[model samples]
Target: MPRHDHASLFIPPALTRRRLLGGALAAAAVGATPGASVFAQAAYPTRPVSLLVPFPPGSATDAIARALAPQVSKALGQQLVVENRPGAAGTMATGIVAQSKTPDGYQIAIAPATVFKVPHMQKVPYEPLKDLTYIMGFSGYTFALVVPESSPWKTFQEFIAYAKANPGKINVGTSGAASTGHAATMRLAQRTGADLNHIPFKGGSEVLQAFIGGHINAVLDGGWAQVEKQGKGRVLLAFTAKRMPRLPDVPTAIELGIQHVARSPIGLVGPKGMDPAVVKTIHDAFKGALSDPTYRRYLETYDLEDAYLSGADWYALAQKMWVDERKILEELDMLPK
Candidate 1:
């Protein structure tokens, strides 16, 4: 208002699930007659719900979805089938959900922050705000810049200074060119007048591999802390609001005079015209899932932040983010190609 809907406030009894849901469908269909998408909410989720996770299985978003699946299934009284459609920086899966012909709330997706930014980068099959039913946001990732322990730079300051001096000589690795990590790094370069080159990989695991192998000078990723703790690398800076307990010795980018923090917010969504009653049911189920101790602990273990926002709130935020990130895309020459 992200996953566990703004502290579960009472939505006034007048806004009952059925009434609110039916009313939304009626408004969206723009006809006096009831449509399939409108009336389907009355007895929603009768069968298995398909959850399309854009990244590969075992990825961060995939882990979160699996963690939430059982809890949501118990609450909804139905099985949640998580389908992995990893490609095109998560846009492939997004397009699948967008093109779903089912009027029922069976098709849904959990995507990264890039869902809101990718359209500005190039042509995509669906529009973010207009094509999807905005569901609750789950959690946000904790990103960091890490280098192999053998690198010449010891701290974030030294790395930045070196990059500023060397310009495009240094290479930074991320998931993809227009992904959140890449955008944040581009923004940082704009703010700092640095010209470090960025190398895009298919996913974080690939980027981590490249970073550890010295194929890239440094890597900006969400999984760096885990690798750093394993003695494989060292995090020069955390892109979080506060210092993580496990890495107290490392400072945040904000502390180093950088104002932007790049965190990938993960969440669920559905095809356009999903019944509001169905939306409420799914939202409540996911909220129940997020409240589970195991899920919360899993998130904490990875230093990810709880960014729960309600359906209405998340929808509003999506619209605003779409508008807000245009400037960043333009600044990075990422508005197209």
Candidate 2:
């Protein structure tokens, strides 16, 4: 059966009566757990919870996870230790959490859109719908199309014109192949008929290093903050729905006649089948951590907003993304043969 021709291939048509009853019975079984086990569920994270960051320490995702860990730990009466496990554009750690036999709330990872979209593009170790438990969404990155300060193209239009005229001469760098930055760059190329050569690195720091060393013409990433701060690059366009407040002078993709916005939000998730009680405990703690002044200040520093969503809502969005990403990848000819 073709996966993209119909949504039914991905979404179940309807819940059968037997399946509904089975769900109810499963809930009853959870309710039927011994009082001691139930109490233990309420007292989740008696030990430190290890929060996995699927990127390097200097990356934006790692910074966000570290910023919230201490406050979430305070709320839960347990420490939240952040561990970096960077590889495959964040799939390495995400796959670890997904393939783990343990569903205890003690181990969770920060999930990005790649968690949903990557599985559609290639064979991954885990399934997005069945292998991971969506926890709570907290924040998003501010992505931009940045070029070196010495580049002659001052505006996005000039850059696009140059890319179109020169074809593959425009070497663009991103965190990794099939990353949100790569996807957005490809979308822009498709929209503007520009032939861009995409160079993928393991993380944003590497991409920045390469861009600064004149190895690439530009990079699409959140690390634009560091580049712009140091006056090493000029931000020509923001891959967002609206003009970023901090970069009000910079036009958005939409304003530049490209009808695309990079909606790459970040969230938390654990292995599937986590106890509902424990899920709630972690969710509530992180939800409260959203208000932490330090985390909020981090958001302000990076031109991001507090994009919070409940677990159920995040799961629903992932379902939509599963279908949407297949279409996007198919259009880009990125799906594995």
Candidate 3:
């Protein structure tokens, strides 16, 4: 993925707690009367904010978070620090954010769509929809089914047919159990009635490695833009509603007669019990950041599409995704015992 230039948006080291608090108090005093300003300086994020990525540092989610951090920090006039806390298929970091002491907008998480799928596969401490305040939905990357260019299966249908005939002989790679890749593979198996074997890795890079090393027959993973560009593999199909502009030749799952699309949409979120005012402030900042030209360029470079949504809209989508994921997991017999 392309790294966005953050020099222009870098937070000054001179930004101190005293200055931030003083600015907040002044804004509060000025806005003591109702209907003062939506961008009231005292509303929320009185200090540096931390955005947690529930995946390892170089993962797609982590890259997106880092790309948006400086822009968000500039928009909010506060430093946005990104912290990696990968474990338990993202539940561990999400659990930490859900249980954190700060709901004042100082702490937030970059939530992946996989968070909705994980609960069906294992015990999770937080409800995907109810335990967090959805601040904004920014961008999403499409999942791709990739195999070596020399593989015998040329198209998605061929791969499905081969898998059906071979049963558990064909192995597929995923980032982790309940990841978007994993859920998508399971759903594909259920839809096609193929008894394929799944091999889980810690991240997309590893999944690609397994596929290249011939340890896995195919990889159902994100970062297709990166993988396909490497020239060693070909994308069998995209698990998206439409063909990606960069990969125009690749067919989508829908185009291949499947009714599902599994892009890993990510967004900003805070722990439950956040003040509505704080949520609004954070949402506005991220919304602004999403529109920044630099950010837009980053999206295009990574073959990611912009899917901006407000807090309410994102929350509704999250709710629907949770329900839909549960149904799919149950149908595939992947629900936890």
Candidate 4:
């Protein structure tokens, strides 16, 4: 009986090489999906991470990424690459990142408030409000109205007066037709009888370029402040209720008796199903970056606020805004339904 018991100690003859292969195949099948790897998130950022900017290089959005990238990299132990995939008024790149299946915290994007309305406006790839996971809030655009330095209009009043006297002669450029800038511009025209000829461009950079080249009389964009700061364009009025800090001398639309604003809140967004822990890690890194002196300096330099919010808070705000913006989009005749 003891000799017979040696069978238990020896390898079972039934466990042939083919059986071993079958066992391995079974294990691999189980490991195919991310859920199968319980510790996948705990070991994140094994390689360089991308911070996708939905605007061209030298843009304010691009500036945000570049300013915070080094600090975020130091916090995460990996390089946070600022990659620009500019097009479609900052939606093309956003859609690319939102639809990304890589949930390992390697791909994320800076989503602007325009995303809220863009989807309802027309058919797009991703539903920004639901499709992407909001990570944290960042600074918003300080939209303003500016004219070339050599333009005849010296003040906001003069511009409006001229517009009233000359109906469609005032040509204005914006990021796009349905862009926040364009919408704000149109709202201004509707309110003040500007009758501005709105010229839509692909991005704010183009709007600014056109304005600088004297292709347009005025440009309604966030980049207007930079042009004013650079002494290229003269800011006539801020679209917001308050004057932009960088252009403190400039009058607000409210001060000029125009009740309007064009501030577009922006935030970080990743593909759906991102691990909570990974999101928290990214949020904390960005929070730290927002607080960094250099980054803050950049924000101030660009006339931007460090509007950082916790991941939970940011998501809540996005959801609430989604509901609010839907109504506005509908009123603007930009709803799918």
Candidate 5:
């Protein structure tokens, strides 16, 4: 028998290299196939979902979130947790939501209308319309220009006249710069040529305190339904298009001949690129909760009015409002310097 060379006994060099290359390509194709990850992404909210609030525990946003959490959980069959991360005119929570992972549907936020105002007043990391998906609108509070019961200005017109005559001397307290209260006050001033001073506070409670202590001439605030009824303060005017039923005698801004209306509405949102299915599920659950007797009673107790909108409708409204607000702020020169 002739001695066989090892190289000759083996497969050809080109064939060996080709076989290895083909095996590696086949393994890569198997690993890269879109199956498990795609399926996992499709079945979202496999665990608890977080609903972030930019206000403190007892705030209106917090109240609504907590009130609806159970209903939402029941509908979704997942734990819906309320997480408070309040600060920076709601920027703290908004920023967290903005920077969170997108399209995962794990993190959602209850954002105030102030989220739009914040970017105009200060440096914010996210664009209000572009960075988040507006899931749906739930509720809104009626705003009022309130003063201590014994204060001199008895009517909205009287207050406007006083501010017009006093120019920058009349001071008012608000939740913060570019807050709904501040914007409403500014719009009032712009429309009437009143030069009232603005004092920004951290929250509504502080705004209320400032007015009660006589630290400020007036407070521009929402949720005045409870405060007005408490008798600590009197509403001069409802800063809305229509007068609140509870404050029937109190004229609305529009009724007072002012072309401005302000309401601090809140809606659920998630990071941009949220899955349409997840968005629909969240919207439907919250919309149902909004109609639930328990939640409706909570709204009545708080004197809040229901303002519902679908995800697409809410998103469109947000976009349009930002444009309208920017124009108003620009006219008043209230846009950040």
Candidate 6:
């Protein structure tokens, strides 16, 4: 499936936390070999767990992690501290988790699309499918193309027209180079014949600061909901398959006949070789956290979809996404020579 497949994520029927935990126990019983560590098979997560956010503070992923940590901590009977380790377009912290000698459930990070996409673009420290244990996918973002309200372009078409006329003169901003927003903007340029110049920032807050200060003509990011609410900018295009309910007036890139659709699925992942019992404990805790009212409201705030998939299912999806994203980068000539 392409990156635009909003409904592609596998969501199973709801199951109670007890049932989920029971299933995990059964799996652990079957998967355990002779002489396996009794500690690994014992009641898991005996201490505080560290949830690392790859993006900087104030990022969407960071907010989601903070929202989920307390709820997960309550379920696991241990505190889940959210640590900010933002860099390398979200790959640095992920590498830290993947490279850890301990496969204990205490250290985990939020895996974004970049987790898989970056390896294909350039050398990375970890293999997406091999070095990490995918716990669960809780949410995915809805991205948009936002421009200052005072700008002359009133719609996506007008913006494209201006870009077409100006060529590389139209400066577009994203959270970072090769990020979901930057890739989507590049794909849109390919499909529309608009030579849009991409400007990368450290994070969404920085991107917004540059956009608001008129340093860039437009920004494609998930952090535009607040900006649009302040009436400082207008969302010209939603880089989603369907129009976002929060931005009903905004048209989607697909609606405008552009085949480019970008979404960044967020999930929890630990180091490779984690115990099945421990994986289940973390997954069940976060599964319970997914329904938290505050977290649900946070999802709505950014128009993010509730993309829940079990550990096994998310691992399979990541395998497929690795292949799919590689094709996208190859097509864009973004891969190294």
lDDT of 1 by residue, 1-337 (tens): 0122111223455567876566665333321111224442346678899988877665666667788889988888999988887777766677787677664778888867788788787777767766677777778788888888888889887888999888788899987768888887876787778888988877776787888788999888775655676777888888878887777898988887887667577777777666666777788788878888878876865667788877766766676677777766776677855
Q: Give the local distance difference test score of model 5.
A: 0.71
Task: Record all residue pairs in model 4 with backbone atoms less than 3 Å apart, i.e. clashing.
Answer: none
Question: How does each model score on lDDT?
Answer: 0.74, 0.77, 0.72, 0.73, 0.71, 0.78
What TM-score would every model get versus the actual structure? 0.82, 0.85, 0.80, 0.83, 0.80, 0.87
Write down the TM-score for model 1: 0.82
lDDT leader? 6
**Candidate 6, residue 287: how far the Cα is off, in Å:** 1.1
- Give RMSD to native, each candidate: 6.6, 7.0, 9.1, 12.1, 13.8, 7.2
- In candidate 5, position 268 carries an lDDT of 82
Give the winner by TM-score: 2 or 3: 2
Q: In model 2, which range of ten residues has the least summed lDDT?
A: 31-40
When summed lDDT is taken over every stretch of 10 residues in candidate 5, the lowest stretch is 31-40
**Order of models, best TM-score first:** 6, 2, 4, 1, 3, 5
What is candidate 1's CA lDDT for residue 241? 83
Write the number of the candidate with greater TM-score, choosing between 1 and 5. Answer: 1
What's the ranking of the predictions by lDDT, best on top?
Answer: 6, 2, 1, 4, 3, 5
lDDT of 6 by residue, 200-242 (tens): 8877777888888999999998777767878988999988888
Which segments of model 3 are wrong by more than 4 Å? 1-46, 212-214
Clashing pairs in 2: none
Report the lDDT of model 2 for residue 117.
76
Give the count of colliding residue pairs in each prediction. Answer: 8, 0, 0, 0, 0, 0
State the displacement of the C-alpha of residue 85, model 4, in Å, after optimal TM-score superposition: 1.3
